[model samples]
Target chain A: MTTSSIASPDVDAEHEQNKTPVSFLGPFCTYSHQATLLAFPDTSKWVLEPTSTIKEVFDRVQSGAAPYGVVPFENSTHGVVTFTLDGLADRAGEYPDICVCGEIYLDVHHFLLGRRPPSSSPESEQRSSGRGGEENPKGVPLASLSHIRRVYSHPQAFGQTARFQAKYLQPLGIEFIDVSSTSRAAQLAAADPKGESAAIASELAGREAGLDVLARWVEDREDNTTRFFVIRRKETTEGGYPPPEEEGKRYKSLVSFTVPHRQPGALANVLDCFRRRELNLTSINSLPSLVAPFQYLFFVEFEGGREDDHEGRISGVLEDLEKVAERWRWLGSWRRKR
Target chain B: MTTSSIASPDVDAEHEQNKTPVSFLGPFCTYSHQATLLAFPDTSKWVLEPTSTIKEVFDRVQSGAAPYGVVPFENSTHGVVTFTLDGLADRAGEYPDICVCGEIYLDVHHFLLGRRPPSSSPESEQRSSGRGGEENPKGVPLASLSHIRRVYSHPQAFGQTARFQAKYLQPLGIEFIDVSSTSRAAQLAAADPKGESAAIASELAGREAGLDVLARWVEDREDNTTRFFVIRRKETTEGGYPPPEEEGKRYKSLVSFTVPHRQPGALANVLDCFRRRELNLTSINSLPSLVAPFQYLFFVEFEGGREDDHEGRISGVLEDLEKVAERWRWLGSWRRKR
Candidate 1:
């Protein structure tokens, strides 16, 4: 069996000993890992603890195994990271102790990483040169794909790089295999002795997994970015990242709620309230309530943070929502990141 | 490489001769296949044509390769089927020639299908007896899981059967593998020589793949149903299914739209129009517009068909939406299935 990058323990011994542990979805070098690294750059103050799943990231933080959790929230092209939503939603009756204390917008750039063919030379690399998008080009010209019969990557990566696949890979009739993570995809491709496979993953993932960069800037869009939530216990002040200097002090909040179904006012009762209050909602999404067939739970993220509700405007909106809606949940209110 | 069920032509010879062909997301026994089978039960009138992907389903219908297409729209537990949404949305300035003609609500019940061990007997099957959710039980007791080291199924099945996984599979340390379709998953499990893997798929899929019933009613929720849309050329009148009798004469329509961003009235204006009209919206979902980061396209399905808009109330709503919204696309106005 090809070894998984996640299967091997990659946490630093020094972090295990002296560093304050922070949780993220890991086996190292995933986008989540990259976000965790960026959000907590001071290694002396914090050690990165990577969990196998997003649920585990929430679990580790909730259980106090780690002080902070970083999980993918959304991608510009692909949209929501579903597991993170599942972890946060529908917690109405409980204490709802975990929250979105912060967010990270990581610019996503997927690379085609593959195992280098034995005796492969520079001329072959020139073939792959003209196909990539115009982005920050690195030092050397990259190699093009050769005999990449199969590709391994997270499904999200495939969604984000549709143009790349249609232009470069689909014509080749290559098989796309969905794995759990991009890092795992990179590691699996790296371990293939036949060199018949390549992975679409982050450059960091490729480097950590010992895969060669077959192509750079392989994603379909130039502005591919993913929003990640930096979460921890709602009441905990033990660990925190200072707000990035580039971000203004404006704040944002997310709340999940339910409205009576199959009626005009079922949802309008809530959305109009926001309009009436002038509470600018950033995004709104709905999922099945699970109690009944057509019932829905709505997750709404808005501009004003609960901490920054100086005029009690946000509270007034919620007060109206609580009365008009069947149920509501406060997920988090954190400093907004543009 | 294993041959895909989708690759083999499953269309009946007689179908090629006289019957109307309807496209479905297929490898011959997916939930979409089941929906297609239910909606087009009159073999003399219609023959089921299965496509490799949701896009292919849309393509076939649009290109008249098939007179109609059956694609999954949403799940009671899993929310929206994104690929289907992507196929329907963001079509402006171009004629959205393909439209949803009808809908199918299939009661989804997952079964653990696998190869029965060569030496197995009735008593060994007894151990799996009490684990499944109570439902309409069949004749003899089903076979129990034996060395089910891996499970093959669609990611949606994994989501719907989370309780079953947590209670039964997780404790056994079984690895969950995601495949393109549940029928493909069953085909893979049935093909495994060692009989160490099982699939979570429909009983129809199991029968098609020649896998045994390892467990029935494996889905976590009793109300695990999926909604599918019957799509065809917008102006085509050559073929259509008679709406199921129980659904009465009620109708539903879905329109995807975008409002200006970073302001309250941006979305609230459009929703308030629906509010003023008392239009009962069934569901609302948002996805990234892909033209820009954080910008969104909203898909809203509400009661009242455009065909039934005698008062022009529906037209009035759309008129206001067109005025306030940046862009919108009329996906379909189909007879709603309860």
Candidate 2:
């Protein structure tokens, strides 16, 4: 994490009063928690609150029950989390108070875990078993995969670790069981004293749940990472916005809008606004509008802070969009995650 | 399905001589099948082959074993299918032979299914149960909710029917099980032959699997739909390029490319290429680059047939992009689904 100088005294005071509790999607120890820790490292400063579902995390933040909520927005391999995006769009009209204020990226590492005796530690067993010795090399067989009858994981995890599953589990006729979240899967695996069931979850989750690591880095891709967003109630002029940016810190603004289908170059016209100002875009995604068939709602992220209007160029683009877009929402602006 | 006139007699003759079979992702029946049927309605003319996975469907098409392969591209409720997108990108360098040539859109309707006999059918039972009392006036109790123990469906199906699940299944303490597909779930429920388990699938799947429809239109959104693609090997000029367009059919072309990170507005400049030619975009999505962290590979869809340019305007844009883009692939040009 990069150390930064404080920007405002009032922002510090407000954070102090409400920073004790923060909510995230979890049974416990999920990627959301990993991202929260990445952004707000000091456990002593903030109380970690775990919600049962992603929607609940958003609800807590919208209701002001938690000062901030952390939710997974996108994964490198899986693409965007539609559940979170849907939550953002579907409830926007109803919960106009909530806005995204920060972002964090967490590199994910999946581990295959199973219940085992504490005496046979994963590290010692791996050391004794030897490294790179063919099939059984990297670690002890840990009760051959042939004995494992069931596999538990979040649906996305199953896809990420497809190669591993095909190599080891498929021939054995293992059954995959989908749970609500990875942490929950870990919890379930730990609860089973027998080694018949295994789970694909984070190393932290496996450790916390007292499950032995059967395999490390099982995901197909090495650089598996998930991006998360910190959502909070909108900070109006009365409370001021996110602490003034530290010198040299870059920022990103998120906005969503709909284009009329009848217009010939409506979508292009929107992109032109960003181009004219040389405001580089980070990402752009479109979701089909529920009310209108074939119509879409575009979610866009662009470089530059909300305050980076040297000549009101950024503001000018926003104003231009407001005029032409069928429906528009200035989601929020915050420091871009390094 | 629209009646399309034969554009090329030579192409038709070639298809007639070689069209032994077409492939789709399946375990007998899936949305892919629905799409395949929509695009190729005359089943007797071409044999229908089912592959175990989406990759196999593409593999079959690329290997020339199948004339055409149908796979899902995106869904209105759930964003793009990343697995399919990744497959398209990862194989371009290796294959460079396959190209999408057609498209289809199918409106999805999820039905609740159970194994109750026709006499104790869901429609008759729900009517007498008075669970909601307002919707069903036919008035005959089927099986009680207490008898239902588990619910099964694809993970996305769970989200689509969240409201129905909450109101009916959740209050009854029903267990949710995730299957590979909705059709597979229906098959499982039908195999049970008991009312203890239920599945959320399509009415077609339920009827084919001998399961009773427990409820109709259980999804939260009424306009749920999925878009699919028809893939075939590319035809070079020497090898025969795509056939000339018919008189009235419009087309959409797909292109993907990576931009240099150091450039200020590299991405915007690419979009400008389209804007300048007045070429309208249908969709745009960015996926993170695996090799270069934070860098992105953009998948863009736009209107205009492959041979639309009288002055080669579209080709000019493609050539200009090849000069500036780090990597580019003209994935395909297909008849746009209407």
Candidate 3:
């Protein structure tokens, strides 16, 4: 694996040769959109299509509007985003032609933005605003969780607010609001009364919206990161592993399956198959099987490629899984540009 | 081993027996407070103080103000609430006697609320209160995701809002706000301009707050249940597991451990010990370790009472775990109510 960043022209040429346009959910500034750009900066020409759901990204790709799509797989703060999981499981058939070609790791930064100094920190900005109080009117202290009346942020930011709420807001009476994106949240806070509204967004968004940073690093954990999947409607190359046919490449595969409900040890049984075959499971996510109550669909990514060393074993496992699963899909296997 | 509700009297007796009041996070309406009451209904007689943070709860217990506390452990939709995890992991020494006794499950229901009638249902009591020709005449159509300028909910509710936002609001350019609880969200939404703001909260809360239900079951999945843990400053009951001493009773142990980062087989190694010992693993949750980056803390619930199990085998497994774990805590071994 090369550590050096792959140049955009080279990645564009590769995507052009593959005849695929990567699709992802975005209006150009959302986190997932940014991740897609980061992962495939030079993939021919990129299209920015607004989607109401992550599945829409996949749907557009399956419909051939684009040959590939990008969706958030998981976050360090929140677990798997179920929309991505259910979309893959529901459209398993369409996705078999699509594989997780690569993954992009991006750190999520949450900020508190407002037009005026928050009640918690009244002084520093008051000096600039020319409002002088007898006592130093400190800018509203972001540390005072009680001072926050309403919190605004993207759903992702909302997820990150879990710890802060549990630790601070839940006790204090602060309220949280969800926004389309951190940027939008910042925009709302800027437009609203700064005293009563605060946005949990990105520093860039705060600056862009002319909002001051009231607090930084509001996520429960400091190491907030999100993982994005680069998905393409292509079968695993001749040999299952992400083909190294081109330089600057890394490969990953995405697979989905539904397991029987109320049957004890169903998960264990499937896991046993992997254990018996000595296959390594990288990550496993389960979403409610939308078709019925109690049923679950699992999306699993593992270390080996479907067409490579463990191909036969995976096929055998799939055969066994078929008996228990109502639906299954092999999304794709593709190499990522580093 | 008795499946009996801990009514007020029993709770009183337990408080007398334990000599500590029970403190939780609530104003008697929040789910956590409700869960606390359900877990120990007589808590009112036993200093049922309400505090804001799990840390505060732990502190009250540690300082001898409260003998026990209840906090949310995890939600089926969102993973573990990290504050509770960190409070437990970071202050293990202060809470040495604290152990998980049992679990309570709560289902999450999100509802949209407003002050006006449904726009489509004119001639009905549900009349749009706002200006006509706009998308939302009764305020904005609560269903029009874009018209929603603000969203409010508990942090946990915020966590669950990811799928909702990704599906409805993100593309529509709506924003979400976080409150301390669903009830609070309802309260704020009811008081806000009907068309401009909506909340993701419980139907009951909306009704209590005199708001109309705009939407229900907004969560991505229906089985959105949250599990809470009962913690007390008491050691495991003697002879609480196995054989005649505790016949007809089942026992479960909760344990927390940190696995070495990047170790492929570290988790498998721990599970292998139980596999070899023929111990059944019931439930397992893995969350990012609060103390370190790139590390994981696993909360595992398994069969058997620690005291009744073979001491040598338990010790041996612990010894082996120490090699792979940076820190580990045997949370508790409790006999389950039959």
**Best of the candidates, DockQ:** 1
Question: lDDT for each of the candidates?
Answer: 0.77, 0.71, 0.59
In candidate 1, what are the lDDT values of residues B1-338, reduced to their tens digit?
A: 11233234566685566778888887776888778777777666777777666777876787787878888988988788877776786332222688787899999988888876667775544332234344436322255455788998888888788767766777778877767789889989989999998989987777777777777788867888999998888777765465335456788998888888676768877787788777888888888887678888998888898878988889999899888888887888887768
Note the DockQ of each predicted structure: 0.62, 0.27, 0.11
- Candidate 2 local lDDT, A1-338, one digit each (tens): 22121111234556566546678876557777777767656544666677766777877877878878888988777677777887777533556777788888888878788854445645545411214234433323344566677888987787677678767877788877777788878888877767678889877777677776678778867778888998888873322223454334678888888887746567767777787777787877777766566567888788886766677877888888987788788888888866
Candidate 1 lDDT, A1-338, residue by residue in tens: 11232333566686567666789987677888778777887666877777767777877788777878899998888778766776777332222578888889899888888865666785554322233345425322255455788998887888777667766887788878777789889888988889889999987777677777777878867898999998888787764465346466789898888887676767877887788888888878878887678688888888887777899988998899889888887888888778
| Chain B global fold similarity (TM-score) for predicted model 1 against the true chain B | 0.87
True contacts kept of each: 0.62, 0.29, 0.06
- What is the per-residue lDDT of model 3 for residues A247-303, given as tens digits with 9 covering 90 to 100? 543344566776555444455555555566555555665554545532456665655
lDDT tens readout by residue for model 2, B1-338: 32122111134555565545778877655667777777766543655677766767877877788867788887776667766776677522545687777788899878777855445644454421214435632112234556778888987777777667767777787877777778888878877756688889876677667676567778767777888888888872321213354234778888888888846567767877777777777877777766565567888888876656676767987987887788888888876766
Candidate 2, clashing residue pairs? B125-B141, B125-B142, B128-B140, B128-B141
Models sorted by DockQ, best on top: 1, 2, 3
TM-score, cand. 3 vs. native: 0.67
Best by lDDT: 1
**Any residue pairs clashing in model 1, and if so which?**
none
